[model samples]
Target chain A: MKFPFTSEQLTKLHARIETPALIVWQPNLEKNIADMQALANRFDAALRPHTKTHKSPLFAQWQLNAGAKGITVAKLSEAEVMAAHGIDDIFIANQITQVQKLKRLRKLHERIHLTVGLDNPRQIDLLRPFFKDASTPLNVRIEIDSGLKRCGVTVGNDLVELAKAVARQPFLRLDGIFTHAGHVYAARSAAQVEAIGKQEGALMAGAKTLLQKNGLRIATVSVGSTPTVPFSVRNPAVNEVRPGNYVFYDAMQIALHAAAPEQVSLFVLSTVVAHPVAGRLVIDAGSKALHTDGAGVTGHFGLPVNIKGKVVRLSEEHGVLELPEESTLRLGDPVLLVPNHACAVANLFDVYYLINEALQIKTVPVEARGKSQ
Target chain B: MKFPFTSEQLTKLHARIETPALIVWQPNLEKNIADMQALANRFDAALRPHTKTHKSPLFAQWQLNAGAKGITVAKLSEAEVMAAHGIDDIFIANQITQVQKLKRLRKLHERIHLTVGLDNPRQIDLLRPFFKDASTPLNVRIEIDSGLKRCGVTVGNDLVELAKAVARQPFLRLDGIFTHAGHVYAARSAAQVEAIGKQEGALMAGAKTLLQKNGLRIATVSVGSTPTVPFSVRNPAVNEVRPGNYVFYDAMQIALHAAAPEQVSLFVLSTVVAHPVAGRLVIDAGSKALHTDGAGVTGHFGLPVNIKGKVVRLSEEHGVLELPEESTLRLGDPVLLVPNHACAVANLFDVYYLINEALQIKTVPVEARGKSQ
Candidate 1:
């Protein structure tokens, strides 16, 4: 495999950077962040970039330092990591239940300006015992189902009831309405993404008005996900966008027409270990690195831009590349690939080798990786 | 959602056991080890259980202690972790090339009885320089394609050519021949798995005999992959079988009919965080926890046993479950799921909470996880 940077740039990197490594192209990553922040600014939305994508406290801090309002995490473990790193404004965009998890949440909430997403009264009831005596009220955004059938209330009586239930708890603050337009990732074109985004902003805005009319105040109406960001933020209804993958747009984003090749930031650096046949090569990076998630748009596992070949398939530890005929690639050649999903790939790695705009390399442990809880 | 264990069993477990966890049923795991060991004993085939399934040094030591001849790993990083844990014999059942990696192989070889898999001559030349003045020769097994056309030689003249080239290097020892019957996972029944196994054993035996007659001495005729272990290990001609997932059979094995549900040893312990609507539930475990790969055999992502539901789909952190009608499951209810592929799921977690037969909880870090390099 070749160094993604120039020979001179490679010379500046600390020796011993190897293949099957997650290399975060910081220049591109910073640009992606700047561009996303600009998008949020254009639409007068507060940017709370999701830390779930990078799962790195350092990266999240970079976004926060760059004017992001806060960060969104999917798990309590992730929020714990961010909070440990002094990221005070943390929103867990997932339900938290279980007596044990609620205790942890209550404790963490006491430390930060924590806002959790809640859809059902059962979760609220579970947290009641812990929150009942909480000195600081736990804030919650009503997770409403916009279009994605994955989670959230369906913006009706259920939404109204949950909002009221959350409001009923003296220790719980009914903050705002939140919805994730995840279905936008499945959209075929940019126009479709825009349509889904419009629906999302309208849905969240509608939920806010509905809840407010019912005497529950809503503060932050948040819409996020990389694919829906550009479109959703454009709508007048959204005030906050929480696009995590924008920190590292992957092949999935490119396939969805949500990102350009130049904007794709993270790459799985691999080394061709075997040239089993003339044109077919096997790289050390496999499903564990590139991940097995479908390339949402391209149908390929990953795209190796430097080589004129495609990562066709992946076993647990072997990436099979069907190279172009008459290719000059050989054994030990460094191949770089943009993965299908940046979030999944990030979770698969324990640490990421950060390559600066100047291509100097350093390593940072993926602090919240495998923090799925 | 329901727990895999009975109420009595759950009562005996550690009070703080959490969700979205990788729990190793140590009793079942030990039993699986004994059963597979019995299979190896029946035919006098030495067991070289692949460590790729667990990627845990602690687990690999258990296999080695259970009378495994050696341990097989998928990557050098995995081998390094195993070797660090005092596993002297390691067979990296994958090709290794590249100047940097070859140097690492040479260095690691100096410490252990390491054997790497190779298919071509260029790899030999690359190692030739490093091993030219080595204290101990680098042992290599020729990898032949049994059925999985992913790697290895075609097993005729190509095998002979590669073997002869490996032997030509004073630093390389063409010790054994290896093949992985990964396609056995696609078998429709135990009989189909046997057929694939028969083909694999016959092919490896045939290749060994052909190579010996062609003037190269060969030892260690190895075959592996958990699905073919039962049938393939029965072949007396095979000396070493490296099936790793037998330590923890999952839904994929159950669908292959290679394992019974009672034989399943690992479970992704999760919690029903959201009952989005009636009968439908969302678990805190998503693709990052349960993963998104189909069961390869049944097209199912994961099967939650005591709970009558399929983990229908997964986002990054939300597993959408389609529960049975009139189910009494609620928020905070524990769910235990047998993943489609245990190996993939294991890699997704930082540690496995070992629940012994007595139902005590202890954590063992997945030592080699994310060691993709």
Candidate 2:
């Protein structure tokens, strides 16, 4: 991973740039994209990476430039924002059920190579009318439950029936089968994560094979999960991999052994606001600035890299750090924290302070910050 | 607690309205405001309600109009936003340490009744230079540690020294003393909360007496915490009470018995996007919409009051609900969730859907949504 700005750049802008800012180290971010793409290329899988973690069309373009074929979004609102920013090949990883949302999706479907995750044929029935009069047929990917147990049809007859129903619809094209190995996050080791990834790939590839045997054309088999991406991409039958969190690996990734301390690209820059009592120092970064994804396995909400401390708890605007018995970090000292979950931390801020090697400062809006709908 | 929209209102816009939207039923909001104001009046305390919870200037105005003497904010950013909306009586309930922030605070102090919390004499030493030549002397409140070991000086020599230093400064008007009884959130019983509230009032009152005996005339004795407000306001010594979360009583409040079910005025509106499993269904709302405050006591991350299910887990954009064995909730069904923590949930959204008794729908931007800096 690329290091942050040099001492020269830090001199010019470090003190002036506001505290509680989302500092996106440009070099590390670019390195993260390059590393993930390299891994995907080595496995011969098309990197259709998830954009929900970054939620930036600018970053999405960088990923595309690095050989990503398409981008995946979790919400229609996210799809709307990314596509409007000239992101062409998009896949919404969640099902849209509202008629109004379906209408919005139809308008978007006419503009890009859009495929939506659908598990229920009833939803296909709803989409039938909207897509029947469309210029471009909406690609429908049946989301099969590999292990996450969140969304998606279970892998047996239910999966086959959903695909058949989509194939029967003239407007709804059966484009692919997809599965998310999100449960890999709970795995105790990289070996455990690999096992989950293999299951995820098998689930998607096997579903595709099952559909093709039933005389249905299945064009793609996609699987993704940041922790499982390394193994999932290696599956020859898996054509597309969509891991979003690889762009800014966080404390959780480090705990899962998916990344090293040097690989964490994002850090929330905060200042020690108050040294209230013994064993704890309050910082400006709180639940609003950082992610409360809980203290993973380390029992530290975040690693305050600049200070020898662990954020033990947070209020709205205060991070209570449990420091070493005699640590000398004082009030107003600039501190940096690598949050437990980078995506949630990114969503909390409106803009990011992009710091490059030469110390050039760039401010960019978190384009899809609240596009959760 | 006001009932959310009538059947007619939900019918008219239920399908058209997007998921993960903050639904502010104005009737309940108005009722909640009036009730809090009444409670404050019953105790003859100034309802200087903290505006950090619902960081909306519009809601702050409502609180002021309903007899709130002033408003409290946790950050300079929050005060800036509230002041821009013509909110005059603003007390920043946190310390300002940075020279830039102090300069900005000085500028803001010129235009409003701004008081800030400070605990350290070193901070006063820093402030002395900035406020040496001021138009209106800055009101300074020495934040004292009541029970929560967060910010604030301890109750003895440290607290006395800070207050005396403030009183001695020519340009720093020693406003009073403030203590946040935030630890009442850990109370499992009303008696425990009441015990914490009594201690909060005693600590502030006792500190004021000790300071006055030392020739420091204390004007305001303030205590604020949502969980302790019910009892804290009843203490005659606490002249100013600043409970921020009363405007939207959440699941935690209901569990604490600080609020009734009918008093919860705010909720998140979401729709069931998929019913892909046997016992669980997914809503379009996720960690971004609801809070990750964890289960208070009920073990329910969120209470979907409008639906017969509990939100068991959340992904970035999906709330997986555990439905009863034979539930009738279907795909495309509208659901309302009362988040465990209201402040965190409110900060996540950009806008709120205001539905009043008249069924007239109005959209207002969550002005302080990303003003966390």
Candidate 3:
């Protein structure tokens, strides 16, 4: 992986900063945003980029300014944070079952145009007590099990039943049907990702048809997952696309051929603190900095830019890189590592350094980070 | 994994709180701390518990009150946080090479007794500019490689040379030798863990002797790593032991037979958000909350209490648990999951809920969380 910054530029940046810092190259970041938005435009789909990746309201605002319809979050707390930052239209793409969270969600709905995902009757029952007497009905999207079996209902009878359940509630409005093709991360090749993507689109479209046949007025048909957005958005039946990782792609995106190295804007800047042997070097960034989420997908902890090595091991604060014997990387030398997953890596830091093309840095607070609940 | 809390207590707690939260069972937490301290006392070793596990100064204060000599941190930022909270004595068990961090270290040393780990000459060179002319010498510990292989110098000439280099500097004090046997996490059996623990102790003792023979005084001989602490502290030559995870044992420790189920204190209180299939239940906690650091040590993401199932899959905000067909877990049901590694999980949350035997709760801020700079 080649870094976007030159060695001299990185040297000047590293001179005044600490190690294990998250760097967001602004030029690449803007390009990534524009490129993904252009793709959504070409497919005539609204881009509701997932805020779970950047976790910053500032980044969400940038997406909204660059033609995103709104924003998507994985949890209610994240949505609350984004709403607090004046992001009005938000979609929570995960199930919110706990009563306390539902109460918070109802309060948030009064302040913004909030849409939540629901896959089961239990969730609707839980939400009824809070939304039953509200002036505005809560917009809910029926989640369909496209390929990722972690959540969502199966796209046949289960989908129809869930949509009906939501539609029957006077306080609940069945706004759409959506599915996330997260199984694309497991695809061994680009062709496999494409296959899963197409299947995901078909499943969501089929679910929409099934729901409409059952006299449900579904307004939105959305497909999520960064790797599958290209193929899933191609289905004319889908009106919205939510892809988060494309904002700052990482090693896993590269491994799945979803993104090129130059498109990856996020990096963990670390300093080689230990050269223990002939072929091994240790950096200050470890699991706490880069995260271990995509280890299984990439078969490595992270990829070091401009180096022929792999982050083979990670403790809480140490990353052990296995390098070639003659590698010039020495102690105290700085290395930028593209984490296995950018979303998980973004959650680890309180602030990220946004670097412009001139290498001037600005601090961006990850305001919604760790708002997992 | 058996939860320390009763179902009634958990239900009440879950009713008022959000899901995907971290809970510290106070009774179990106190017991784990006492047990480890008693073990260290039995072997006549000082307990410098690593604060990386809890990341809370209040928890560190409890350990110190329970007869801990000092506290150990993984980074300079952690040490700075601990020091700000009036923790006057801290040993950073990792290298500090960055000039900016070294500058901060110099400032931190003025207010506290700070000792840093050093394994190479480059680190010593980095320190010279800041500590060379200081009135108070900065304490430096020679890091010996006791089979972790991530950081630290070898036990022979490399150790001696690093010691000599530290002693040569006017403002740098060669205070001790330390090693973390993290490789014990890879031990396939109890016997293998025991073997690695013994080797760790022997290597540290041997390195101390080698440095002393070279006319360098080594005051502290410390060994770290939770699973190996019991065996390593038994070595008469070892004077101090640092075991962070013993404060909150998790599934990884249970897998290594280091701690039993009852001793586990920390848990991710997550709600079952989806029951997509008969055998699969998806919880709200995932890699963002529980962390994926110990997935390699334990073949599962986490262990659910009172349930005969494992967390089979983890996305950023969802945990997919594969259970038997007879299981009674349903949507909106609360489940307490013991994470694979408590340290990494602690880093993910900003606050931890400390619950007493009476089922009362108090929030403890993870003061040093995200201080990984």
lDDT of 3 by residue, B1-373 (tens): 4668778778899997787899999998999889989999999999999999999999999999999999999999899889988999999998888778888989998899999998888887788888877889999898888877888888777777778888888888889999999999999999999999999888888887888899999899999989999888888999999999999999999999999888889999999898888889999998999888888889999999957788988999999999965578777889898999999999999999999988888999999999998
Per-candidate DockQ versus the true complex?
0.72, 0.74, 0.82
Residue-level lDDT for B202 in candidate 1: 88
Every candidate's lDDT? 0.84, 0.84, 0.90
Task: List model 1 lDDT by residue over A41-66, tens digit each.
Answer: 88899999899999999999889878
Best by DockQ: 3
> For model 3, what TM-score does chain A reach?
0.98
Candidate with the larger TM-score of 1 and 3: 3
Q: How many residue pairs clash in each candidate?
A: 4, 2, 0
Tens-digit per-residue lDDT, A26-123, candidate 3: 99999999999999999999999998999999999999999999999999999989998999999999888887888898899999999999988888
Candidates ranked, most accurate by TM-score first = 3, 2, 1
State what share of the real interface contacts each candidate retains: 0.73, 0.63, 0.87
TM-score of each: 0.97, 0.97, 0.98
Task: Name the docking class for model 2.
Answer: medium
| Candidate closer to the true structure by DockQ (higher is better), 1 or 3 | 3
Regions of candidate 2 where Cα sits further than 4 Å from its true position: A1-13, A296-298, B1-3, B6-8, B294-298
Lowest lDDT block of 10, candidate 3 chain B: B1-10
